[model samples]
Target chain A: MIKFEVDNVSVEAKEGDTILGALRRNGVNVPTLCHMEDLAPTGACRICVVEVDGMRGLVPACSYPVAEGMKIKSRSPRVIEARRTVTQLLLANHPDDCLYCSRSGNCELQTIATELGVRQRLYRGQRATRKLDVSSPSVVRDPEKCILCGRCVRMCEEVQGVSAIDFIGRGSSTVIGTAFDRGLNVSSCINCGQCIVVCPTGALTERSHVDEVIAALADPDKYVVVQHAPAISVTIAEEFGVKPGTDADGRLVAALRRAGFDKVFDTSFSADLTIMEEGSELISRIRNNGVLPMITSCSPGWIKYVETFYPQLLPNVSTCKSPQQMLGALIKSFFAQTQGIAPEKIVSVSIMPCTAKKFEAQRPEFAPNGLPDVDYVLTTREAARLLRTCGINMERLEPDNADTPFGERSSAGKIFGAGGGVMEAAIRSAHFLLTGKELSEPKLTALRGTKDRKEMQLDIDGLKVGVAVVSGLGNARTLMNEIAAGRSDIHFIEVMACPGGCVGGGGQPIGLDRESVKERMKTLYNIDRDDALRVSHKNANVQRLYREFLGEPLGHRSHELLHTHYGKRDVLR
Target chain B: MTTTVDSILAEYAGAGRDALIPILQRVQEREGYLSTDAIVRIGEKLDLPAAKIYGVATFYNQFRFQPRGKNHIMICRGTACHVKGSAKVLENISHRTGVEPGRTSRDGQFSIEVVACMGACALAPAVNVNGHFYPKVSPTKVDRLIQDCRDEETN
Candidate 1:
């Protein structure tokens, strides 16, 4: 431990700790804009500058190492002045449209400016007019509002391992953009929304479909139906000032109904359907000597990543569509048939904890006869906003159940919100398909946490099966490389593009830290622990759906509606 | 005849990212500019993203994204030249050719660029076209230079 004096208070900090880390540990609050946890500090923003005892000028606390006997004044007058100046300079070039910005209430820059008492613009200069990039169906880029914090750039290149955007050009002309300053749609972007999650300003946001959804809701001829992902119910509570991980599932359904959806469905029911199809596919591949080590295709971002980077492994990915798309297809075909409504008149809308689902819903494969299966997608944040726009407070609503036929889901489907939940769910069903009996203890504790990667080997009916679950595209890339190099121990793999799976997705509530994501995962596990129906194969509604409409898993009707394939996609690097 | 991006990349076989600059330079030398296709090929060879490679390439002003025109024009905006009204000469050339500095004309016949210094401060305002320098250049001289290049193209 190193002893230091912060604000005249004696403190002890761990050796090799940065001054910012030590000060934060000591309960000293020093504001920072460009600093991200677990990332190498760039010290680009001098907002965390402190008045060190021996330093010639104020030093940035984010990168400066804590030294023994070092004296620092984090909130001294000189330090405050320096921070104010830096904030003023950033604000000088920023747009004055915060009232109209998507991040109006939650922007870090506005909060920091308010804290620093920057009431008025101190320095005004000619603002550089930058073009807005809205080519991607999922994410939008407003370069005029960007403060050049480089958080989105680092989050894209370092954390996600998809360098679709970077700092282009030099000095004052530098702006974060895709290759050749082209549209992000043509770039190597997986549309994970991780970049939008890390951006401090209103520079990055999901392409909103709330207006069109409202328009659909008002149309008397359109039978607008809505489905909410499993992760949405857990994380949407945070947007309403409720504690993180609070299961507002029933309340969310009630609120959606209040917001004028003709029918509200649960995507978890389709997730159970995914497990049935994907698990049967896995068992068949094992029995028939098909593609070994078949990877899951639940995450759209991971699908695009594979399509762009590792096109050779396209055949290895499971042919099952994601829960969002699966439910959309079912809503148009089965649900519409059951209701005696025309498929074209039924508008399928999904509320997801993802931005990539927007891109996934728009894929040409998901559209049949040039008619899209899913009409609109709203992120959890956007859903919260829409509910608020309709004067529907989740806290005040009574708990309500989802509509019948596609609402009932097993706990195994509910756990699909977390990273390794899919693998555990699939293993339970795959074991049943192979041995015709449920496991003694269905809870695979090995695959139940928020770790980046988890693997387990199981002996199911004397067949040794190896399984691995990985979240975040970077870790997926590493495991993929190993698999490509002929490491063939694993028989099935589950990959989610966002770290900690959809609970930590790019389209979840913004400004969420790792702790919130862990809490959401814990809530999903808690739901699974307490629920009665824990296996996807035992879901009565899913079995009834097969008997009523689809013949069986991977059957002709199922293949037409619930399964899809991916091909090589050419992108800008 | 110019070499292909594949042949140039093959010469740097078994090399890492440290060979990026040299590979880009070689491709630029052969192709007259760093085309998007060339950048993508280099990224595939070096195991880097095209955006990162483009970022690095853009940091240095030597890399050009557009192909050079038939008549390449470099106008000096050095300390001495700016004082001698090179800005007006630049404005005149841009007005005549409809090409901004660091951009090529639509017809692919003329390109304009502004350099910091050519170390010829003694000439004050100077313009260099196709490796030939015209010292103490005025607006009228720029017009005449454009006409001479056009006349040469007709010939």
Candidate 2:
């Protein structure tokens, strides 16, 4: 660690850490736009300028490293003026319509501007002209609101391992876009929505489902059943002024009830069912030589990445709908039959942390019973907005339980929100089914952490079970490359497109600091540990669903409702 | 200066022709200029052996691959750029050519590139066409004077 005195403040930080890192660690609020803690600093925004004692000019805290015993003035007059000037120059070219912008209350620029106390731009004239591109089903791109920090470009290239978008043209005319300015749907974009999450303004946002959700709630004929993803429960608490990683599961159920949801269910229950189907498929593939390296198809972002970038690997993906879709299918068919409600009156709404789920729910194959199984998908942020609009103070509300059949889930299902949870959940059940001998230690500790790639070789009864789990599209690329190169020998693999899995999804709360999200991940794992029903196969609700609705894991009913197929991309070709 | 240029060029050569992206970036970074001859020599060293390098250089707007003036200015013309008053800034810089983004100026005093989305949306109608990041850029503030490669001032 390196210790330094900055303007009479004693601060200590690890070696190789930037001045910004040190200052942020000390709770010094130095504003920034282009810089994120997890990303490399390009020093493009010029917002975090700080005055150094002996230095000639204001230096950007983000890129500059602190030397031993460096004296720094963080809130000096010159530094403040420099920051204001930079923001002014940025605002000169930025849109003045913040009131109507989707990011109005939550915009980083707006927050910084208010913090800096600047009301208006000194210079103004004709802005640049370019039409907004809203062609993609999942994301909306408004170039006019863009600040050109290259966060989306960096996310696409460095994080997603997909260089689908880039900065094209030179000064003043420079813009971030797909090659030849093609619409995003035409590009190799995986619709992961990481770009949308990283955007500091309204440049990119999820295609709004507010009106559709409201309409569904208003229709008295419809029985609107809402299912909450495991990750959303942990993150929705932040919107209610609660600390990060607080599991507001009970409050979430109550809020959905207030939002006019006829029945509030937990997708974790369906997640348990997904494990039964996917786990059975894995064992079958291993025994029948069905396919090697059978990949998990839970994350739609990862699924699309496979379609666009690794189409040749399609045969390896699991043939099960994500837990969200599986629940939607069950709600419309099995739950409808059980409740004695007409299938047509069922309006299935899913609140997920995943932005890609928006597109995944709309796929043609998702409609199993001649109707869209999942009628509406709201992001975690949207769910928070709904709660706030309904005057539901989530923090004050008493914790309530989820509805029957769909509400009952296991620790295995709860863990699915984190990176290696799916692999751990699958192995627990697979070991039980294959060996007829339950695991002595239910926690598959090897497949239950935040590492990018985790691999374990377990002895299940007499046979060896080798498995791998990976998160983030970039990490998935590295894993897939290993498999393609004949370097991997794992039997089963779980992949999530975003780092830290669904809890760190692109549709979660905006301005999500990495440290805060990591804490939430720990909470999710704790939720897994604290529950009595630890395994998916052991969940009473899953057992009941299979017995009453679907006869068996790979039965005809299961195949018709839960199974799916993959094909190569026609656009990339 | 020669050592600085040589070492930077050597880094690009080690990366190969696919290194064209980083090479063009280095040339722009080192000399603060991208001469056509520099592009040709870099292409020859990388063994591309085709106009592919030059085509790529012109294809994406960021690659200058040509010598430019001391001051490089960029004005954003993205959707936010339109909404943020980036056109007036463009008009002010229109007095120069060849270095005016797609085309920089005839004189070696300035060069420009208009980019799409710089991800600084809250400060939209932004411009980094040059190496400088002008958040809320305005047209009236376009007039400027001379400078050499000495400033090294970012943003």
Candidate 3:
């Protein structure tokens, strides 16, 4: 341990700890902009500068290591001036449209400015002139608002392994741009929007369809129906200040109803439906000498990653559409038929904990007769905004339940929100599909945490099935490389592009009561455990739908509606 | 025509991420400037994204996107030249060529470039035209220089 003095208070820190870490541990808060929890500190943003005794200049507390007998003043007048000046310099180049900006209240840069008492501009310069990039269906990039902290660049390259964007120039003329400075749709961007979630300013945001959704809601001719993703309920609380991981399904439904949705349902119902189709597909593949390892196709970001990086694995991907797409397809086809309404008259919308779902909905295959399965996709944040815009207090509203038919879902479907949830859900259903018997009391506990690549062997009716669950594209790339080299004997691989499945999705609340994936996982798991039905096959509504309409899993009707094909793209454009 | 990028990429095969900069340098050297085709081909060869290759290639000041002209013009903007009003000389040349720095003329006859220095401090405000050097240049001198280049080209 090393001893240090922070604001004249004697403090001891572990050896090799940065001064910021030491001070933060000792209850002395310091401002930081370019630093994230687990990322390597670049000190690109000088907002964390602090005074050190016997030092010539103030050092970045985030990157500077604490030395023995060091005297650190994180809130000294000199340090405060330096930090304020840094923010002032950043503000000089930033756009002056904060009042109309989406992140006006929540932006980290704005918060810091308020704390630093930056009431007026101290410096003036020519702000960077940049065109807004709305090329990607999910993320919008406003380069003029970027402070060039390099967080998104590092997150994309170092964390996600996409390396889609980077610092392209030098000095004051530098700009963050894609390869060749082209639009993002043509680039390798997966539309994950993790960059948007991490951006401290309004430089990045989900391409919102809130206005279109609002217009649809106000359209008297349009019978607007909405569905929330499996992860949305657990994360809505995080966005609404009602404690992180609170299952706000009731309030969420009430808000959606108040917001003028004709029907508000759960996507988990279709997740259960997905399991029926995917489970049957996995069984048929295993029995009929099909592909060895079938990768799950739930996360659209992962789908795009595999399509761009490893096109050869396209065949190995299951032919099932995501639960969101499946539900969208059902609402338009089956629900429309039963309600005696035309598909076009019913405007299908889905609230997802993902930005990539917007891109997925826009996929050409999902649209029949040029009408998209899900007409408009809204992020959870957008849903909250809509609630506010409609004058619905989501917090004070009484809890409610989802609508009929598409409302009922199995616990297995609810677990699909977390990292290993899909694999476990599939395993239970797949085991049942194969042996016509359930796996004992405890589930596949091995595939339940935030581990990078979890591999486990299952003895299911004399067949050794190897399944691997991996989150984050970086780890997925490693597992994919292993599979390519013939070093992996995995039978089923589940990949979520974001770090912790849809619970840690890119379109979740930005810097608002952010909770650990483990905590989020607990909410999903509790929902599953507390429910009466545990397996997808036990969804009575789904069973009846199969009995009445679909006939059976992997049937002709199922293939036409539930399953979809994927082709390798030379370029996304 | 030069050898295909396939052959150039074969030299840096299996180099992966580390080879990106060197391969970009080599591609720029061979192609005169980094082309979209070259960037995409290198991305395919190294299993890296095309945007990533472009990103790394752009960080350094050495890379250029536009092809160079038949005759390249370098205007020194070092401390010595700046002290002697090289900025005025640059503006004069740019106006005469009808192209800004880092751009080629429409006729593809002349390209202008700005350099930090030409390492000729003794001859302040120096300009390097193609292979030859001009010292103590002025706005009128820049106009004469362009006229002289055009005259030589016509002959």
Candidate with maximal lDDT: 1
Q: Summarize candidate 3's per-residue lDDT along A262-287 as a digit string, tens digits.
A: 99989999999999998888889999
Cα lDDT tens digits, model 1, A191-217, are 999999999989999999998999999
Highest DockQ against the true fold, candidate: 1
For model 1, residues B20-47, the per-residue Cα lDDT tens digits are 9999999888888899889988898899
Q: How does each model score on TM-score? A: 0.98, 0.80, 0.94
Q: What is the DockQ of candidate 3?
A: 0.56
The C-alpha stretches of model 1 lying farther than 4 A from their native spots are none
DockQ-derived CAPRI band for the predicted complex in model 2: incorrect
**Which candidate number has the best TM-score?**
1
lDDT of 2 at A240: 65
Model 2: how far is A461 from its true place, Å? 1.3
True contacts kept of 3: 0.71
**DockQ (Cα-based) per candidate?**
0.84, 0.05, 0.56
* Backbone clash count for every predicted candidate, in the order shown: 0, 75, 1
* Candidate 3 interface RMSD (Å): 2.6
